[model samples]
Target: MSQNRRDPEQVVAAARKGAAEAQRQQIEIIKQFAAIDCGTGDEEGNARVVEIIDRQLKLIKGIEITHHYAEGYGIHIVARLKPEKPEGKILLSAHTDTVFHRGDTAAYPYHEDGDTAYGLGIVDCKGGILVAIHAVRIMQEADMLPNKEIVFIFNCDEETGTPNGHAVFDTEIPGAEMAFVFEPSRDEDGVLTARKGACSITVEVFGKKAHSGVNYLDGRSATVELGHMLVRLYENNDNVRGIQFNPAALYGGDYGTGIVSDHATAKVGVRVACQADIDKVKEIIARVEKETYIEGTKTEIRIDRISVPMERNEKNVQLYETVHKAGLLLGKDLPEQASGGSGDASYFSYRGVPAVDALGPYMYKIHSTDESMRLSSFEEKTALFAVVLGIL
Candidate 1:
């Protein structure tokens, strides 16, 4: 090693100091992120958030930034930092969009009280974005940036199942050795080692329409058939096995009770623990589509979106070990967990890149009005990530 190059302990010490110095700036940046109304499908709102991130990334020299736009979806930003003699590629990702819709920020503006910060979408992902930004900034400022190709992805669609973000991953993640997703850590300070697969299904039922009083027996009730199918689907939910079958919304029938309904539609959400469980869910759906409660009714099942599980495998475990070692350097023991909620991390893992998640601030009540993050965690996680980058 060159005399000018610091040892591992010295590099980590410099990163820790940088993280402490950047704490106030991180909070201000997170507030700016929280002020944006970048809901999942709000193109304009998402674009505004993208601009904020772009401006921040511009502050770091030698970064190559590109914007990828998906028709009918929002923009996904990819920033790259290439060293002269690259060791390998590292992927760090965080979503720009949140579950909060437009006008949510106006209703509940970003605010800090005591040791916590609260606002719409503050913790769900806005905080995560700040973590990634500060981590890179810390590494750059300390002159401790590794000799690797660092790829940072700020996806615009994640709350709605990453409709457009996956395309960005397909292009960028191929040669990356490992990935880190800056989602909020679990309330207990646990990082995600595994996540269940999720599927959004739309079931439509068709039936003959007729006047209830004039031809009640001739017409088949689609609503009645839908109810039976929903019951069967809900029966597949096994809490003990971590399988969730939720019939979230139902729509059917006209206002007049005298008329027999012709159409019915239902939206169902399913979560499975493993890849095999996905097949089981599909089998159940196939059986439901084939069987009918009403003799004349026909049912159609359409999967709106599907996210495969991030199973706990050796590669993922090895990545977690690296993260754990980094956490130990910071005097923290980061526990690994298997989450029921799915995330973009699963996409990279499925594509053969070792991945770990929940590397952001400690947060709770995500996607709810009470969503908030611990202010101190911003500095801690930033330091953790900077050290991880250094040691890598």
Candidate 2:
């Protein structure tokens, strides 16, 4: 990498000094986002988050704002800061929603104790949004805004990968050269280099219904067929290839006991390491679909959603090196790792854009009640991210 105009250490020191004054405001903003109670379906909470961020984005002069909606979700907030004489373009992304329900914040209200912030969405994304926004805002205060047009995207449905996450490629990535994503870090402050691809599948089975003890022979139990299909799915799961087929939910039958049900449904979550393996997993499901575990049972299948794999491509390797160099300048040795889970980074890389994932705060046990943001690590991320912006 060629030497950038700015010195990383001096730029970071100035940012840290500026951050020291506004650390309290950052905490307050995080609390505001966490207390909103935005889960997958809570439109009220989702809209509230947009409102809060909209107000913040408006403070930056010459910023253009717009919105994009995810399928069944509320919105994806987009903001751009274009200089009159700009160098190029950079895209920064983070999600606005969390995995907890609307009332989750009441049980786990936003509270901080010394080096940590505790709340429902504190680590998974609220904290990330805070870091990403403030990383630029603080740099701007130090007159250190990146020498590129910056686009900030806060999508609503990353926890449950939705239309907004993938929809961004068309609406948000135009003319942008690089994308930086802010999901939480993992395994002692590591950066994500690669991630698995996923496809959501649904299987439904139909059977004849009849009375239990009276006409048991006439009844072809859909429940029984589902049991056999579930086993076949399990058997087809390939461990060596890191392919997982999990039957997450099952629905069928009726409230009354003895009556055989005619309809049955199952939702399966599939994760694969490569995009090509999606077909392999599908063939496994197809093979099971053809099997007739029950004489009168019929089945239907649908692939609900799919995102191409975030394999470690050439762009990804180069981006990791850039982040690694930025970390070294800030006195942080950021390790790199591959994840089985999916993130917004996958979509960007699939579009042939070099993207970096997991640039948010450091925390453990995300998507759980125990989620907490380490204040110390949060400060480190703020500093390193500011330097990364300078170099990139």
Candidate 3:
């Protein structure tokens, strides 16, 4: 039963069968995963997740598992499965960390009601992790696994933009033909063809402090300067299509109401569609920084944790078409859409790896207590992923 001699329809049918058989077990696995609180920077919790995944991957016989750890970030696991007959290389990635806190899971554990499963990070990525793992397992059990070198990465820090796991991707992404990121599909089961680039900009304004009543005219208020800057920053949002500047958090002034504030700080979240958009954002930030709402006030800006956009390119569209064909095989129409959210997919797609995202379950309200994934989508997406791997 050589791969070339096998019928594509038969392979897809086998994937669907395997997916159906594993549906219940997959749900249980997600429950197990959701019980652990692997929030970003929770080293112990994230390590526990790594151990679970590592132990499971070891049972599969030929997977070469490597654990990468950074000082502040938890472990990142890279599991490679090389086929007997290698056709090409494929990369699969999912994040282990969520945006919730350590006790959030204890307060809101995984629960299933009818066809929806709810938890803190269940859909945001725990479900996605199961999809990546079980999709490979289903293909293997069906004897329909493709003759491609499969590299799967379960990263620990995606909610914070993968500052630690980017190093692993830097090494693993090259030479890979296509990448699938398990980042939970849109509520309507839409896969992401494009995602906005993101960065955090922190602005600090400094001015001289003085008594508000006695030295009102002489004193420069940093708080007033930051207030003006925030308004200008918000104006950048939608100024150009697909570009946004959000002043997410602001801190300024002491509790003393009688004193003019000497310092103010603003944390802005910037999202852009392309390099040109990023450049435009920088220009706007500079303009805001230079304008003086209050005399003698100086501003300093720091931009860090930048992630590039996942552009909708031809290769990405081709990969989406492959997934779409797989969906049709399962009698599902998985629409392709663009997302303002950023993920690990952007890393590969930005580097020309032909990446597609949201290959995970169909879920909504991720990063919140209302986070839930459709129970049926687990089987459906797993089957779709397995079929895509087989046909590729």
Candidate 4:
């Protein structure tokens, strides 16, 4: 007969063991990932990661791992851990993509000093992945694995907003009960409780090009039309609601020999606090689109919802409390915080699954060359996750 509940003492002990093991194993994982040149298009990163997963699954609960080819980028690894029963499925998501390309190590060398491991993607997510894996180990070893099933999704291309991973999750996320993301935590005491939603938009304006010296008055400049739209876009930014509009990229006909630009396009990035804000921004963008500043210019607009905001609520607050208290028991004060970026947790939170982000080890300089994680922070967070699992 199998046991229904695990002893608290046994669970605690197992968590401690798991935490220790995680530290040791993390060194290997880091070294392995370091060997891969997984910038974005490199397939070696995927191959190396798959090899590590193969070894990890053998030691832990080996689940099905699939490789997906996301357009415009490299492959994404989707791994699942299914329970015997079909209830209580939680997802732990992380990203494997980084902003650095091949010659990055020369600019930002990967090295260790005393207790900190420094390298690309170390703090941004690889360290976070290590934390999640150990958390699962704590639960599995203590026989206190979630009463619900769990899905461990470590994807590629998150550095660029799941451009490819989003579709993959669309097929897999509907069945999850909750999710926890291993994003880089704020300084040290921070836990990400909320994030703003983001949208990428491009507004194109077309006009008749004319000679600047001779026919400037006869032609309508598309650049002028784009300028007017950008003015309105900036005005729509409501800092109170965290709704921000930024004209990120602007391109028009020939810059060096710009006589009268015939076409101009601007890529804007909008960040909203919630879905309501998203709709509001859409309204604002529509209004801007209707107004044609240049008399003869034809304008077009395209919008893409990059990532939805991870809105916070009572349910997430409860989970945060559980995690916070666990940290206190480990003699650390972990505070639940909020962020301004989007991540996979947004999918689950919007689905009413209640999630928390930044449960990974404390790290800094993520998405950049100076990425690194503290050995002590990882150890404490690992133990706290174990404690939280027991309480849950």
Candidate 5:
């Protein structure tokens, strides 16, 4: 039997209503959160929001939000939507924390300009969080929620590479069968099916500190040693093969004081398309760790595997199929895309659960001071989300 085609007029109307409701609901939540500055290690900020959401959850049936704390600066919020009867589980993941320093949002809150909103974390992820909430609300109103269980994960720390967040998730929801990450989509009409593996690493060099003029020969410069390692790391960059290693932050001695540096630090961000390539590059990092530039200076390496690549698979094909059919019913088409940026979808897909990211609306200038999500894409994405849930 052919699925009944949905009228674009009616669908758009429903989407418009849904979007308006969502925006209103979202704005309220944002205002509440914006009142409190939710930076990493801000327990009070996280607790305030979690407590509010929990109280609201008590009134809603089959929905529960749990809070878990990871080691320093790590928190995970798991929102579970379970139907009366059991079905497959679907995970919708988004991070709540922003890259901005503490009190940034409090100082510069959300502001609107025609159709766009600008704020510290507005586009990077808070918009995605609001989208998930509104989508779920629509699902409840339509009474079309599937027998399948839906879980919305609001990770506390994603901008910091989810060191503790990933561990908490792996321990909590090991049974999830599928996941959709509400990360900011790329440009317009962008959807993500694949992402590169990511790593967070710190390079520290130690050297003797001495006065520049009196004991210049007595001190080895750690900053110079760090530069050598950085130069070597850059030589292997290959844009064609999707391999890029960048030095995100570097700190060294005080230059104006004329003191030879005794310590230096550098943080590196590595992205790789394939697991084999990621493993291959570790040799280069290891080589740098072993070699020393300055005499009597030593270097220490702290390499961490934050998240792995989500390779394309058959399960992803099935998900795209369902999403595509739902789009057709609504007279829209959402193309499958492979993304290079890393997201929580990488965590689920790497663990064998098929996942798709960039499921939210089109967002621009993410992680910037002028970030914004398109006004139209909000309704479009929510409608698509509701339709997909009903179909499943």
Candidate 6:
């Protein structure tokens, strides 16, 4: 009874019935949101988003709403859309924070031309939120909404790897059968099947400082040792192993010239494709700390913020079938592919939920002033999403 192998023509056609006009009207949602500056940790900008979401959700009927917040992070809004008594739970994961700084919106206002809308976070997520909002509204009007506990989890600080939002997910992400994340499609028509996980590894070296001209032989240069250690860390970046290590920041020596450095620190970004690779990378980090290039230097390694890899698995393949069938109904190719970027959705994948991402729009330039997204995919992707409720 699955449409996984069904012909494209056999797909249903519901959203396209009037998808264009509906999207044209609702497109304003993204524009209005894009104009507001909601950078990571921007209180005023995030507050503006809270106001907008609060106003819009108020228009919908019969939905349970809850607010979760982090002390310094923004807010996480969860809304359950269904009858008081629902059939099942399907979680929709998304975020409201953008990488745009304050006043960036003022310089680059939301602009649209020839089916493309350019603005900060437009393709990254504001457009994604718009599609979901319109999908719910249109489905409500057509009386096609199924009796399912469709929970919409929108959190702040996703731009910063959901640091504070983890509290929000711990409270809500459980019990969901699956999670569909809207992170912008891999391409014009590609949905994500897998994504790399990331972590930060910080290594510090402590060395004895001595006069460069007089007691140089007794002194050990931590900076020189760090340089050798960097080579070892970067050697772990093996394409075959699906792991990448990049030295992001390096600080060595303190103050002026003619002095042996006492301290050196190297901050590296580690990305892994799977848990095996994650372990391998961790081992590599440990190995580097044990071997010191400088004789007198002591090395310390600290690895933090390990994210879950959304690896392509059998469960995700089945998930792709369901979403592909929904896409078929919309008469579009819904192919699945791997992505290199990590996101908050990693948590759900980490928590044992079959999750897929890149469900937003078709756009490339993200986190920059030239950011833009295809308008047509908004209608197309939303159309497919509108049908997912019935199928799930």
**Every model: Cα RMSD to truth:** 1.9, 2.1, 1.6, 2.7, 3.4, 2.9
Clashing pairs in 5: none
> For all candidates, what are the clash counts?
0, 0, 0, 2, 0, 0
* Model 5, runs deviating above 4 Å: 1-21, 55-60, 208-215, 254-262, 291-296
After the best TM-score superposition of candidate 5, give how far the Cα of residue 254 lies from its true spot, in angstroms.
Answer: 5.7
Candidate 3 structure quality by residue, lDDT tens digits, 118-170: 88888889888888888888788777777789999988888888887888998
**Model 1's TM-score against the true structure:** 0.96
Per-residue alpha-carbon lDDT of candidate 5 for residues 255-286, written as tens digits (9 for 90 to 100): 64598898999999888776777776687788
**Clashing pairs in model 2, backbone N/Cα/C closer than 3 A:** none
Q: Write the per-residue lDDT of candidate 4 for residues 247-311, one digit (tens) a residue.
A: 98899867545488888999999887788988888888888888887798888877865578888
The per-residue C-alpha lDDT of model 2 at residue 254 equals 71
lDDT of 1 by residue, 145-232 (tens): 7778899998888888887788889988877999999999875677787998898999999998989999899998999999988988
**Candidate 3 segments whose C-alpha is farther than 4 A from its true place:** 1-4
Question: Worst 10-residue stretch by lDDT in candidate 2?
Answer: 1-10
lDDT of each: 0.85, 0.80, 0.85, 0.75, 0.73, 0.77
TM-scores of the candidates are 0.96, 0.94, 0.96, 0.90, 0.86, 0.93
Candidate 2 C-alpha lDDT tens digits along 98-217: 889867888888787888788888778877777777778777776778768999988888888756566665676777788888898878688887889898899889999999779988
- Local lDDT at 292 for model 2: 84
**TM-score of model number 3:** 0.96
Candidate 6 residue pairs in clash (backbone atoms < 3 Å)? none
Give me the displacement of residue 165 in model 1, in angstroms: 1.5
Say which prediction, candidate 4 or candidate 5, comes out ahead on TM-score: 4
